[model samples]
Target chain A: MIVAERKPFDEIKESIQDYKKVLVVGCGTCVAVCLTGGEKEVGVLSAELKLSQKAESAPAVFGEATVQRQCDFEFLDEIKDIVGEYDALLSMACGAGIQFLAERYPEIPVFPAVDTTFIGVNKDVGWYEERCRACGSCALAMTGGICPVTMCAKSLFNGPCGGTNQGSCEINKDQPCAWYMIHERLSKQGRLDNIMKICPPNDWRNQTPQTLIQPGYEERIESSK
Target chain B: MKSGSQLEKILTAGHFAFTGELGPPRGTNIEAIKKKAAPLKGMVDAVNITDNQTAVVRMSSMAASLFAIAEGLEPNYQMVCRDRNRLAMQGDILGAYAHGIRNMLCLSGDHQQFGDHPQSKGVFDIDSTQLINMVKNMRDEGTFLNGQEIDEPPKMFIGAAANPFAEPFEWRIFRLAKKIQAGADFVQTQCVFNMERMREWIKRANDMGLSEKAYILPGVTPMKSLGMARYMKAKVPGMDVPDYVIDRLKGVDKKDQADEGIKMACEQIAEFKEMKGVAGVHLMAIEWEHKVPEIAERAGMLPRPQV
Candidate 1:
């Protein structure tokens, strides 16, 4: 899921300093699962922002709202009438959701209240780790299902580096070297030959911003036509 | 002559080759390099120019290697994956080779956290194994990493580092074998302060027939003092300095500890010379280059073979 963290309190306060009333919107999808931008997080952040504003002169009023998902226009339209009541909208979703909110309501100033970090998975209750780089081209098939692009510090496609000590990485002692795990996994599966095949340089052009039409939707529309 | 490198010729000639290390000055001072290499010229076959070792910034290894070549000393140019991407790394290979460097050592480099710039990002576009393979591709096939044809690729005798004392010790040999399979012509290990651990690693390497594939030279760092011994044992990661070594260093007088360290290094070299699959000793007298000649002579490795 997409992982994100709340922006620093001071930075958020400064971004909405000019507004007298603000709406804090949270998404219930990936950000909610990661505990970053959920309904409960929206309340907490709104209360904190109110408290911070109260400490300073000319305090602003804040209203909290959460939707099932922020990326879709239908889910965001639920609060269309009340959204104009606030001076600005503070989105607690990932980058996509924040941008979608701005595009939906072109009049109100939309601001992101959280920093989208990466596409990651929750390791534990409060711990999250990045698992995918969304490089547009995946190499998990050859790497024994381990994503080196996201796990390896350098995003190297080849085998482990010399700094791979024990099973941990040289950059951080706590982080396991991704390539080491790849090597071990491939060796266990008797597919060590996969590691020997040199991967070509990554073609990053596939990652340019563009809408990807779902093939399922496309096929359905064609049959109707 | 695979690459016409002095170290390659010496190792291939079936001699107990002796190599030394030279850590370039932190600043741009060629005189410091000349002074360091001067004492190591006649005593060792080739000198390894460390590339910002330990992540503390230093004169570029390529420039220092050219200085070594100018001083009539063969240089084993060391490069790390911590600072450059594939394009820059490949470009440096051509640059270093054009400047008359014949030997190249590929390493993953120490983490930036250990160096002065802890906040800096590490550019490990390729690891040491990949770096070795890339260099081999350039040298053997005359092609860049992108598979593009090069007019004249760099001709280098490639080397890589190994650590026998790292955790999951059993996997170290297999890593070395993988490095050899990746096109490492020679392997220099992390400093061997723990002879028992090194012996076991060497035995496994020989048993696996890794030596037949590449030259394995055990790294030896002469402890300048008891403090150095303790620092390596306590602070340095992956360094397995046994308790007895510290006890032995503590047993010696403070003033005599340096000599004791040299003596201990000589003893290790003498043993490594006879060990099967061991090619030679890579003396890393960190900041104590003057002691190398003395240690080599006492270890019976003097009068380096002229290949």
Candidate 2:
């Protein structure tokens, strides 16, 4: 899942300082599931902004709303009628949701209230660990199901560097070495021989930022005929 | 002979090679490079110029290597993936080679957190292993990373840094072998303070026949004081400073500790000369460059081979 964190209150204040009336829109999907930009967070942030404005005598009136998913136009259409009531919008979702909100409401100024971190898993309550780098080409099968691109400090394809110590990375003693875990798991599965094969340099041309379009979706009418 | 680097020539000629490190100053002081290269003129084969070592900003290693070349010293120019993308790295290789730099050391540099700019982002587009392979491709195949033919590719003698003392001690030799397979012409290990551990690791390298793949040069840094020893033991990651060595330093007088450190380094160098499949010793006397001549002479590395 895409993980994000709420921006600091001071930075958020600066981002929306010019607007007197602002609507804080939260996403109910990825950010909501991660407990970052859910309905509850929108309420909490709206209240905090109100309190800060009251104490500082800042001419800012805060409002709150939550959508199922801000990226989809259908979910955003629900708020189009009421969006004109406010001067600007403070999006409490990931970067994509924030941009989508702006694109849907081109007149109102949109500010991001959260920083999108990475695609990772929630290890425990209030803790998360990154597992993928989205390098486009996945090598999990070759690496015994572990993503060295995100786990290893150097993202080396040919196993660990000389800094792997006692299963910990040389960069930090607290972090576990990605290759050590890969080696152990592969050894358990009697596939240590797989690591001996040298992986060629990563082909990064396929990883550039671009849109993915489903081929058949474009020719649906022709296909039906 | 492959790259015509002095260090490579010395190692290939069956003579024990002696290499030293030259850290460029933090500012644009070109004189510092010349001053550091003076005492190391005839006492060493090639000088390994560091690239923003330990994350601190300094003169570019490529520029410093060029300066060292002007000072009549063969430079083993160092490049780290932390600072540049593959395009910049490939371009720098050609630039360094154009300026008479034939030796190169590829490193996965220290994290930016340890350097002056902790907030700076690191660009590890390619790891050290990939960097080695890339350089090998440029040198042997005469092609850029995109498979475009070059008019005259850089003929670089590739080198890499090794840390035998880091975690999972058994995996160190395997990592070294991987580096060799990745196209490293030589291996320079981290500073060695524990003889038994280094010997055991070297024995494993020999058992695996890794010496035939690349020249192995063990790194040695002379401790200036007891405090330095303790710091390496506790603070430095991937450093193996045994308890006995620290205790030995503690046993000595404060003023004589420097001498004791030199003695210990000389002993390691002597043993490295005798160790089977060992190429030579990489003396790293940080901030104490003037004492290298004395240390090398005492270690019987004086009068460097004229390859």
Candidate 3:
């Protein structure tokens, strides 16, 4: 669930001010769940943009289209016949989908209508809040299902911070101190002593400085060649 | 404060003009009532404070408008029957006029579930058409929904919203006519975009001979950014956007998209001005009030008529 916020109209209008022919592409995946990139959203934005810029270009350029998912090659293929007609592509998908569209249709440029926020789930309709950080690691078992890395704000692994008050995080009063929740969960499960063990100031290289993984099955063939 | 009849003006001028919109809070904070009403004053001829817009509970429309008038922004008391019934609706209409709120934007309102409170019960006393007719009866005929004559009729400017870009365009046109026939003095449409479709809708209005019978104001909200455009199109009901607009959103740097949005909106408003049968443009610059003057200026719609 890649959460994203729809950019304001003025900013979106400026991006395409020069182009007469434009195609709005909607993705029906992570972006849709967060209410940013969806078919309905694509329709609304298309209408809005027209109302925003009443001027039309020669040969009558400007229209809208939606794909099942811009990230997937199959969906991109669906728009194959009509791809060349569009001068530009406005993708309502996540950053990944935008790049995929760029690669699929290199002739035309792709723009983002949403500020891809993070991976999160809809608490309910019209609401989505961040949850997981997707740190490429799973430590839910030891931490009693709470990922202290993301929830702690500071990403602390030890017990509650010295400034934690009434189980609230010192960094943000609205947030529940992740360590406190971890402590309570671990204590209830008779694993409170796990806090005594040190994991050593996590290897900075593994935690940050950027890392990438190549597919073992696919990339191995290329490397071997 | 003697105000000429908006209805009489519409009927006489053959075309009427009015700036329409509901006032949103100045900020997220809600500490004092006066702090809330400060910005809306003297900005709009009549401030329309919606009843729990977005279904998110805040201040009641009536109470907020009551406060709005107190602060000197002529309040257009939007009375939606989404949460009230025939009895309550009639009572509120009378209540609002008593409160000095003369203008109204009638709506069926977004589903309560769509708002923050999903479990909130819906009280659809009457659909927007029936509600409009009811108010018309009270205003013109001085009769309640029950056919009882009132000592004094409520004087209100009944304004309705239509979404020209609503899908299955035929239905949208048909509904707009229905609202006008039901005695809507003026209409403030859902944000207009897709100029071709709006032109088509206006053509349909011409066909229906409503090209002159009613005041049809096309709604336009300048998309402030690509992100905001996405939110409105995806989140709002009965909103439509074409692929071209979305594609236009593409190829732009995020940091610069806002400027792009403003430019696009100016062009749209200019085009809207050119279109025949379009009475006016309802600018819904949700939270982007500061940029509206620039939008109006650039669109060549600066120095808006003194409505």
Q: Candidate 2 on A29-110: residue-level lDDT in tens?
A: 9898789999999999999998888767655888899999999989999898889999999999899999999999999999
TM-score of each: 0.90, 0.96, 0.53
Model 1 misplacement above 4 A: A55-57, A106-108, A135-146, A152-168, A171-173, A177-211, A216-225
Give the fraction of true interface contacts kept by model 3: 0.00
Between 2 and 3, whose TM-score is larger? Answer: 2
Give me the chain B TM-score of candidate 3: 0.86
Better-scoring candidate (TM-score), 1 or 2: 2
Give lDDT per model, in order.
0.87, 0.89, 0.68
Q: Per-residue lDDT tens digits of candidate 3, residues B160-202?
A: 7776663334445556666777777667777765777888888
Better of 1 and 3 by DockQ: 1
Question: What clash pairs does model 1 have?
Answer: none
What order do candidates take by lDDT, descending? 2, 1, 3
Native contact fraction, candidates in order = 0.32, 0.39, 0.00
Worst 10 residues of 2 chain A by lDDT: A204-213
lDDT of 1 by residue, B1-307 (tens): 6698889999999999889999989898888888898889899998999999999999999998988998989999999988998889999999999988999999878877889998998876677778888999999999998899988888999998998887656556777777788889999889998888888888898888899889999999999999999998766767778999999999989999999999999899989989999999899999998888788889999788887
Error of 2 at B57 (Å): 1.1
Deviation in angstroms for A19 in model 3?
Answer: 76
lDDT of 3 at A201: 24
lDDT of 2 by residue, B1-307 (tens): 7798888889999999999999999999987778899998998999999999998999999999988988998999999988998899999999999888999999988878778998998887888888898999999999988889988999999998888887667666777887899899999999999899999999999999998789999999999999999998888877889999999999999999999999999988888989998998898999888999998888899799897
Q: Candidate 2: misplaced stretches above 4 Å?
A: A55-59, A205-207, A220-225
